[model samples]
Target: MEVKQNNLIKSLRIQPLIVVIRLENNFFNISDKRENLLLKIEKLSNCGIKNIEIGWDSNPEWVNLILQIKKKFKSINIGVASITSRQSLDSIRSLDINYSMSPYFNKEIHLKAIKYNQLVIPGISNIENFKEAINLGYKIVKIYPASKLGVKFINELQGFKKKDMFFIGAGGIKSKNLKSLLKLGYDALVIGKELRNQKPDKDLKIWLKNC
Candidate 1:
């Protein structure tokens, strides 16, 4: 299904927590690793996580796994991240992913996703990149390395030019500061490392209850 921007906006407005799983480079090491990851996704889904982005790697096996999950789950929005090359697009085209995410604000990638009728979100690291993305008609954007940029930087942009702009805070965001970042006006939060490393199901239950 081709996901529209308005539909994505509505979904985000209702559920703003985006769990980003950075697939370990050594994911294939464990036996039944594919099932393990899918089980993790099931736990997250049962906890009411409506959105998830598989980031960090874009291997074919991972792409196939996404397709399999998408077929089984009817409610979740599955997205593939780190789409920077045409080869990446071709590799996962059959997956029919709900959306695409990038770690950089590249016009080529953005346009390519659009051409494929997919909702695309670009990551912006600075005011300049943010401006360029907004000018290109991207309403939803991810603020990468939020920890480095600090809450003060976000507060300063409260009166941004684009009133409809929505920001997803990612990179170095942990359980300790997730609530604070959400309160600071980040439309959504992308969590990793801290939330998924040990006992993700237990952590997600506690974290989401507070949200």
Candidate 2:
């Protein structure tokens, strides 16, 4: 688990950005939706995206979809996100994914992840949760609703940051503000809705080139 965690940290440092892809329910046209998703991922791969997180779903076919994605895109680092329940954890356990993430910290969920030897990065919104995450042996954490917290919130936590600790800023992150946020303190940023809502804009394309 330690080695896997370290590898993920190292990969994040090199790329420093994770594009999250959330699939909406389209029970009637699941096949078309899956194809659309593949095309979107191909576009991201062309844009030099190195990491991606697919939101977990309760649908039985979700696991097979992930397997297909992994087989199709071997180069990109794939992770599961929105893992907030025991069922969600169990769903991905057999997938052999390198890491997964929860939107908020849950002691029971996190402990179960450890027992399974899966690296689940906990999400923390405040000092209290952040401290608890550290105590649980987490070196990587996500700051959800990062824009709401602002740069000052992360900067203030610098004093408490442990060596090798990694911070991933998510929610309300735009291509324009990405660099500034990373400079402020976040080790990486997660861009989801913005990219999914529209094609990768010029600024994002330029940024990916340098990344």
Candidate 3:
């Protein structure tokens, strides 16, 4: 687990941008939605995006979709997001995904992940949760709703950060603010709706190229 965790951190440090995709049940048919997602992932891959995280779903086919993605996009590192419950944790225990993330810290979930040997990065929004996460032996944590918390929150938390700890900024992150956040000390940033709402825009294209 240590080796795998180290490798994941290294990969994210190198690219520093994780494209998150959430498939919601909506008006569109599931087949069409899945196809569109695949196309978007292909586009991201072409643009040099190396890390991708798909939200967990209750649908039975969600497992199949993840497997299909792994087989199709062998070069991209895949992870699961929004892993907030034991059911969700069980869903990916055998999938052997690169990593998984929770929207907030849950001690029960974190302990279960350790017992299962799954690398589930906990999301933290307060200093208390941050400390708890560190005590739980997690070196990687997600600062959720990062835009809402702003750079100052991270800057203040720097005092509590241990050596080798990594922070992934997620929620409400836009291409325009990505670099600034990274510069402010986030190890990486997760871009979701803004990036998936359309094809990569000029700013994103340039950032990907530079990355």
Q: Per-residue lDDT for 102-177 in model 3, tens only? A: 9999999999998888998988899999999889888888998898998888987788999889999999998888
- Residue ranges of candidate 2 with Cα displaced over 4 Å: 27-29, 196-198
Let me know the TM-score candidate 3 reaches against the reference structure: 0.95
- Residue-level lDDT of model 2, residues 75-179, one tens digit each, is 999999899999999999889998888989899999999989988888888999899989888888999889888877888777899987889999888988777
Write one digit per residue (lDDT tens) for candidate 1, span 17-96: 77777676677566576677788888778878888877635555666667677887778988877777777766667776
Clash tally for model 1: 0
Task: Tell me which residue pairs clash in candidate 1.
Answer: none
lDDT score of residue 174 within candidate 1:
76
TM-score of each: 0.86, 0.96, 0.95
For residue 49, model 2's alpha carbon misses the true position, in angstroms, by 0.3
